[model samples]
Target: MVDDVADVAELGVLTASAAEWSVAVRRAEVIGRLAQEPRVRIAEADEAATQLGISRRQVYELLKRWRAGSQVASDLLPRRSTGGRGRGRLPEEVEALLLEVIRSRYLTRQRRTVSAVYEEVVRQCRTRGLAVPSRGTLERRIGRLDPVASVTARQGADAARALRSAGGEPPVVEGLLEQVQIDHTVVDLEIVDERYRRPIGRPYVTVAIDVASHCVVGLVVILEPPSALSVGLCLAHMATDKRPWLERLGVEAAWPMSGKPREIFTDNAPEFTSEALQRGCDQDGIKQSYRPPGQPHFGGIIERLIGTMMEMVHELPGTTFSNPAERGGYDSQASAVLTLAELNKWLALAVAVYHGQVHGTLKQTPAGRWEQGVAEGGRPATVSSETAFLVDFLPAERRTLTRTGFTLDHVQYYCDALKPWIARRRQLEKIVLRRDPRDISRVWALDPDGDSYLPVPYRTMSRPPISLWEQRAAVARLRELGRDQVNETALFAMVEQMRQITEDAAARTRRARREVERRSATPVTRRTPQDPAPLPPAAAQDPAEGEPVRPFEVIEQW
Candidate 1:
């Protein structure tokens, strides 16, 4: 039986025609509101029916169908099976296989003819003993594919660039989380470490910007270089609730944006193309698009936003100022003050300020544009489990599970969850393990059944949690000491010694730098893209209430 409450917040409904899908979206907008109310009222039902061009009874029927079907936009999709009189939908397995083949074979540079693709589908169905869809059906399916996606796949992104919509909005973006552009850059600022309060180096920042509203939806800053794990962490932040995150940062601001993107566009960097990222997006139902090689303009939205952000960084205490010419021999290392956490807090406040300022093209704030979108299409769905979503994107490692447990980088992991697999270890092949590069205290193991992941912690729970970079640094330190074969104990001992040395050094310098305090005393205002708004007193908007304020600036006209 077909599920009435399917809630499939997937990509576009490709099976329906564009005109039909348009009508469905309009209905979703109207019906989505009534579905949320605890009880439908007489006046409300009549108004909704009038807006939808349907009878009051039909409005009730539509609401019931939406509640039972894919609870998102797909719930209101046009279908032939509503009355159970027309040709019902294909079997789930058959439908999935057909879509998969069409996407992989037909929608490619090869540009196979519909007839050829249909024949291939027919052969696959015969092998699998499933019914073959007709050639007419295949052609219509191809016709219903998003034009931007079709051109990008069959021709190239450069060809698709000509088809993009203008007006400062993301090309062809009509809804939130429809397409997000994520990119990474080395921030042009030297940052200090939390331990010794000394300059560590410049850090990398990965940012995700929503195309529809030009909102900065996700951000990540770390001393480590950008990698697949950095992209994963940024994604995890993008989809989950940000309230708790903001509260922890002690930033009192409204950043209500959070949802999984239906399609994400990024540059063709190794981190963006890694198997871990590709498989993770596939697992989470995210479609990936890359800008064509040599076409820098394809990534203009994200790149431009990042460049604007760097202008704000220019006002900071330890700013490198973009280049040696801009720096003019200023000692960024000696003047560095803000640690990674403090810098992140400053960024949060800055983004909040940016969101409130009006966008020149849209003539409204980014947050206002976002709320306007919600008023029409409804709020996007947020991820239910942060851990589950993040596990899909974490860097993967394959290890053979012994009777005891799995080992990686000389560290062992075991849990009661592995007891069942221990007996079958000999028959089992190498199992996939995923560990967060940020924290290496535990790893998530893909179960033999391949459906769920099991959390495995260190065999000896007493070991302290450390980052992957710290672990490598410790190992390098031991090697420098002429210890050829290092054990787990020796590796941890070196790490502890290193931590003690940094702590003792930190004890020597307890006073704040005079230059850091002076520059940080005055707060700079973030200007809007269209019209520059006057700076509000920083103390009034400060999340810390009354404290030294970090400056924020961006010539939004850029």
Candidate 2:
């Protein structure tokens, strides 16, 4: 029985302390059963004995003591002698010595182990002519120290601070889409440009996941890093129907989930903390909750979802995998075959697969779980329109309205709506310019009444619809070509010409390198009639020796 008890303790099924609690609860229940049936105490004692697997007399004695007005549970539970650790075994002076040594030497960034501290404690005991406690006693003392202090000693202040809130289990979100998490991670696969096929770089993917259903509601794959624009675009994708977008990519599946989430949980990224995002949330009646700073585990839901998607990406041809060891000798850049557009389509398909496949945690496909949630009366919230979402969530900047029209980043913008404000500066007035980071060809100027935005087009029609990245690249290229200022027509025209030139060059190179085989061609092993006779080594003099030496006469100079 003693060995069995030790084994149980080792297996963590039951401990000495836990067993004592179990006995105390049983004692209380048995006592309560007897008290209600005083006349049938003997019969009750028999039943209780059988149920508890103890002798009947023991139950009787327990009831007798309970009837005598003692705390039955407390008296039954195990207690140390004199309510303390084996009293008088280790001197108080010696315990204090050990604690002081641990606090001063062990509980620090130096990471002094308990064994080292114990050895030092022995030395201190000898110096003080004190009795040395056993090693177990010293270890127990160390274990009893405050957990925060212990972590601080072993790790550092940051880890110790994190430990404060890391102790509890994650909060339970009750309903599907009741809370959603959003985060961004750079996809670990290299991609190339669609036209030039030159290696661009790894693209960032911002994903929003339903916390309850574990469904990936929306994602944006772009060459840009995490930014407010990406966050807003991700939210727009979440709140709007995705079927059209998926269909554009030739993805044949159903993405029936889309709605404005009630609450959004995010980390302390600047994009999440940006003023535009906060204002949009407030305007849309969505509550935004930021995870505590320095505690990334709080946003584990979205992070894990991103990780899951990246794992799927790893199966592709040019994946970077997760680490150098996993990648080994794989040439990610040279092996890259997918362009950004192709990658986006693949991501859409992967998301479809993710939704269809059963999740280990949800025990159901995310799509199935989402359908179930909707069937059980879970309705998704939605925005007015995609245009409204973009206008509301896009970042805003301040610029002064001028007669030449509002210029931003060295580009001028004008529209019929801006005619009234031209050369007329309202008192203390600055036009609020809202530009979409994805598209810089246009911007919206807020009306003075703040009722609507006035669309402002680029000053030149030659500047076709282009993204911020393209615009920047064009400007950089012009600068490289020694241009001090950008001529809108000339700059954009040059960009288009360069793109055309590259495409034509690639086409020509491919065409010129094409191999052609003629049906009449044959090997000369049998000396075909059309084949010329091989020249002798001496007769085939090097071309540089001018073997056929034409006669020439030197002209006399006057």
Candidate 3:
């Protein structure tokens, strides 16, 4: 029995001490005997305690302790600490000031370094003429401060509330191709230049992720903001490369490419709401769903993909574009392009690996699940590829009317196709042309096929100050021709006549003003008479006088 008890003790059924069981049993017996005694309970209790090898006073004390513990347990009471010590270290006011500094000086400026904050605190102290604390003391103070910790907690609570209000539980993607989320994320990376030996640009990375597969189907990196072009390129890539996977899975390779994803989800970005995108979906018969604004969790799959890209960027050799030798002194544009190229290369490899590997969520690889779906006879939805192409190609633009037919981007294009219709309805003046900003080569005109689009080449007209060289040359030629043909003599004669008439009018006006002034003022008497003009001598009288003098002299000499 001792060996059995030892075995029981080893198994934890009984404790190591054999006396413990005896003590417990004796205590229980004493309590039982005491309960049975109605009158003279004190004497009975004393007899029971003596029989149990415990004192009557000791038994009463043990019962009282046990009852107190039981009451405490039943009440779920908390015991106070031994000391009445207040909170340690920093005062509430100081802690609050620390948190304010953290928010205003640190968080707002994105300066998360503790050392930086320490220096700032010292600077502020010096400016305020307060005693500056040591770095360690400041750190301790910071630790004591909550520092808007509740803000994050409150945000999480609000997100939970928003998720609840969004309605409907999140869909459980069972297999690959079951669901896919498409979205664009801006990636900040320095793209290095091969020729310039410097980083040139930063570009945005638009990605489409398969939720169940965790595969990046398509990715496009462009310098411009996320536009319809970027989105279309991504979709086009998915349609081309993943066609086999889509076909084998009996997924619709039609309009809404990606096999009419059970549901298409994206954020409420303007590009997603563009007419081109909407028309493309209409052509593909794909129903698009938009997530609530500022609620990224609804499209968490793609948002997480963005986070993964950011992580990858962080792990790169240079986190910033400042490294001239390493990342080639790249500007935002160069950085963007290089990052996109690297991202694409990495994405391709990652996607291949992801699709080949068995997914934890789906319990099968994407390729495997796709094959299974195909074998299970999933119907591929029919969509017109032509219609899809048309919708994707169509560009959104505003309509405008111009004098010379229709002007698009300052280029006038007269559509022969639209001419007849305009003439028949006499709506030539009302006919407005809308051109795609992306493809200025094509003007939006009514074509013969009754489609309101006609291809017109893009051209620019010269303005007044900045006329084209050809226009300037033509103007110079016209001026030269006019100069050669014009009569200079007639022009001079006309100018002379005009000058004489102007002088005459000015003299008359001066005389009239003088007369008015003389009549208004006191008149002054003339001091001297004007000299008379000398008379011209008559030739006949002068010759006669000279001849008479000569004849009289000749007669006296004879």
Winning candidate number (lDDT)? 1
TM-score of 1: 0.60
lDDT of 1 at 439: 67
Greater-TM-score candidate between 2 and 3: 2
lDDT by residue (375-444, candidate 2, tens digit) is: 7855575443455465667788889988777888767887655656664666538877877765566676
Structural RMSD, model 3:
37.4
Write down the TM-score of every candidate: 0.60, 0.66, 0.43
Per-candidate Cα lDDT values, in order, are 0.75, 0.68, 0.47
By lDDT, is 1 or 3 better? 1
| Candidate 3 structure quality by residue, lDDT tens digits, 280-354 | 566445567888776767887787677766666755543553244655554343233343345445555555555
**Least lDDT summed over 10 consecutive residues: which range in candidate 1?**
531-540
Q: Lowest-scoring 10 consecutive residues by lDDT in candidate 3?
A: 549-558
- Expressed as tens digits, the lDDT of each residue in 398-455 for candidate 1 is 9999977988887888877687789889899999888877567777788787556766
Q: Pick the candidate with the highest TM-score.
A: 2
TM-score of 2: 0.66
Off by over 4 Å in 1: 1-171, 477-484, 501-558
The per-candidate count of clashes, in order, stands at 7, 2, 20
